[model samples]
Target chain A: MFLQSDTPVQLVSSQSSSVLGEETIVLQYEAGMYYELNEMGGFIWSLLQASKGMTVGQIRQKLLDEFEVDAVVCQQELTQFLDDLLREKLIEATAPAP
Target chain B: GASPKKVYKTPRLKTLGSVK
Candidate 1:
């Protein structure tokens, strides 16, 4: 998975995301991919939108504070979810600055 | 530390399609 606790991530410029009601819609024009992120997905997307290049650990802390879940499970699921986004070319993850 | 018990739904992405 591309997401490490210290890995920083930001949304790709080719994509545009908007929130409608409870769901967030991401449109990737270059690839013509339209994604619908709901529930936890929406939350994560919003964070990335607000702050560019936030570390995975920071995002996870926000999730842990807002939601009730075991740390292991949260990490596992968050990693998988981020992997999917990476595979889909919606977000970009980078190593933290030294 | 028992707060209100809750379940977290794993974030999911549903791709509509690639633009033709």
Candidate 2:
């Protein structure tokens, strides 16, 4: 599924995560699958764990604020990361409220 | 003035196999 900039995303309830040194380890209970996320990926995961979740644009902006990266590159990398989580059912994205 | 160094590494997600 193509995710728009405003789409909201959150971690799925079935998944759990823990910090291991610089990385985050995520476990998908139903599938008994383990996924490893690098430091940047862990930061994004924490944002999604927020009660209100976060939009793709919001995440991109946060990365820009916290790191020195080109806007276009940030968006591209963020999109790919989120897409991977979505594909693995680690996260779910919702349409922005109309 | 020089800009801060770019610390951004492309975010990655890798599957580490299943518990079962």
Candidate 3:
């Protein structure tokens, strides 16, 4: 599913994560699967862990500020990452407040 | 002022399989 820029996302309750060096390891309890996130992926995961309902746009801006990547590339990559998380049931997205 | 040279890497999420 395509996540809107303003949509808020939070980690699913059935998982636990650990940050080891530059990588973040997440275990989905229900699926009994382990996900390894690289440096950039770990950075995004850390953001979500720190804040319970951060928006996609907020994440994109944080990436832009922390890295030298182009804005378009950042948005595209972030959306893809979040989409993967959503598909794996590691995270859930909420509709924007009306 | 010079900014950090780190470019955003395409975030990778590797599934390592169930631990059971």
Candidate 4:
């Protein structure tokens, strides 16, 4: 099901997203400003950018298809990564319904 | 701040603080 969060996290596609090595990246937009994301961040960001939108489960699925990691491991890692992105304001994730 | 290059072309990789 689609979610609706006031501060839902989504990438700014109009902005230039570039990969810099394995775990480094630069997102440039809104007046030459750049945001640097590390490797894990880049991976998550890459999926988001490619699909435009993916749920927590979808992200985990992608990880499963790409890497040889287990589902539980991927889920935990993806969930944590999503949480960090939200906490850091990197992404706008709607809070669970009260 | 010194000054912008007369002709801006090269990308300046300045160290960014922990904003992200």
Candidate 5:
């Protein structure tokens, strides 16, 4: 399923991350995997780290305020970016309780 | 003031080599 606005997400605690210049490097300890994120991806990583389980929509709104992009386009890109993170197990997403 | 559309470049994510 695609990540929706309300999907709550956070960085995996078992992982370690460091930033060098514009790139962010994340190491998943248990899996022994390394994932590198570019400048914009770094920005998104910071946002999620700052607020645990922040919804996808909230993240998009923050990005819209900081960057100039159409809402639709921003959402689309964010969805794909988050999906990649999920695939790598770098972040976890869950639905808010009803 | 005219605001220019921000050029959004897709962020690159790569394996960048890995360790077992």
Candidate 6:
């Protein structure tokens, strides 16, 4: 596991707001605290979680089976999400896991 | 060769600093 079980993320959902929006999510990521995702975010969230330490190629195939989203859309959205997560240090990414 | 730089998610006093 990329993250040891002891270093688990603590998710504080959007309880502060009644509606969870894109901008709200962008603002909600708290460092040292993992995010609890909403519906749409959940799909993307799960993909990244399962893809930890795996190649992006593997992530693509798994996403295809898991959601009705197109490969291109999946790639684009997932990429952006991952990029933000990386930038935020919410996840630690390796070099494609060889 | 360089250690990774740490970026502060919120530098403003209001965001996470207001945690109560």
Note the B-chain TM-score for every model.
0.25, 0.45, 0.30, 0.20, 0.21, 0.24
State which docking tier applies to candidate 3: medium
Candidate 6, B1-20: lDDT as tens digits: 75443221211111233232
DockQ leaderboard ranking: 3, 2, 1, 5, 6, 4
Which model is ahead, 4 or 6, in terms of DockQ?
Answer: 6
Candidate 6 segments whose C-alpha is farther than 4 A from its true place: A1-36, A47-52, B1-20
State the lDDT of candidate 5 residue by residue for A2-37, as single tens digits.
688888999998789899888999898878999889
The CAPRI classification for model 4 reads as incorrect
Give every collision pair in model 3: none
Best by TM-score: 3
**TM values, all candidates:** 0.89, 0.92, 0.93, 0.58, 0.89, 0.47
Best-to-worst lDDT order: 3, 2, 1, 5, 4, 6
Residues A1-98, candidate 2: write the lDDT tens digits. 78889998888899999999999999999889999999999988888886466889998988898898999999999999999999999998998868
Model 2's C-alpha root-mean-square deviation from the true structure amounts to 2.1
Candidate order, TM-score descending: 3, 2, 1, 5, 4, 6
In candidate 3, stretches whose alpha carbon ends up further than 4 angstroms from where it belongs are B1-5
The prediction achieving the highest lDDT against the true structure is: 3
lDDT per residue, candidate 1, A1-98, as tens digits?
55689999989999998888878889998898898997789999989999999998999888888888889998998988888899888999987889
Candidate number with the higher DockQ (2 or 3): 3
lDDT of 3 by residue, A1-98 (tens): 56998899999999999989888999999988999999999999989999999999999989888888999988888999999999999999998878
Candidate 5 lDDT by residue in tens digits, B1-20: 76665556675677766678
Look at candidate 4 and tell me the lDDT of residue A69.
Answer: 70
Residue-level lDDT of model 6, residues A1-98, one tens digit each, is: 23221222322242232224532333343443333344555444545444445544565565666556666776666556555555555455543222
Per-residue lDDT for B1-20 in model 4, tens only? 84432221111122234323
The sequence of per-residue lDDT tens digits that candidate 4 reaches over residues A9-37 is 46554455567675444544333445666
lDDT (Cα, 0-100) at A17 in candidate 1: 85
Clashes of each: 1, 0, 0, 5, 0, 0
Better of 3 and 4 by TM-score: 3
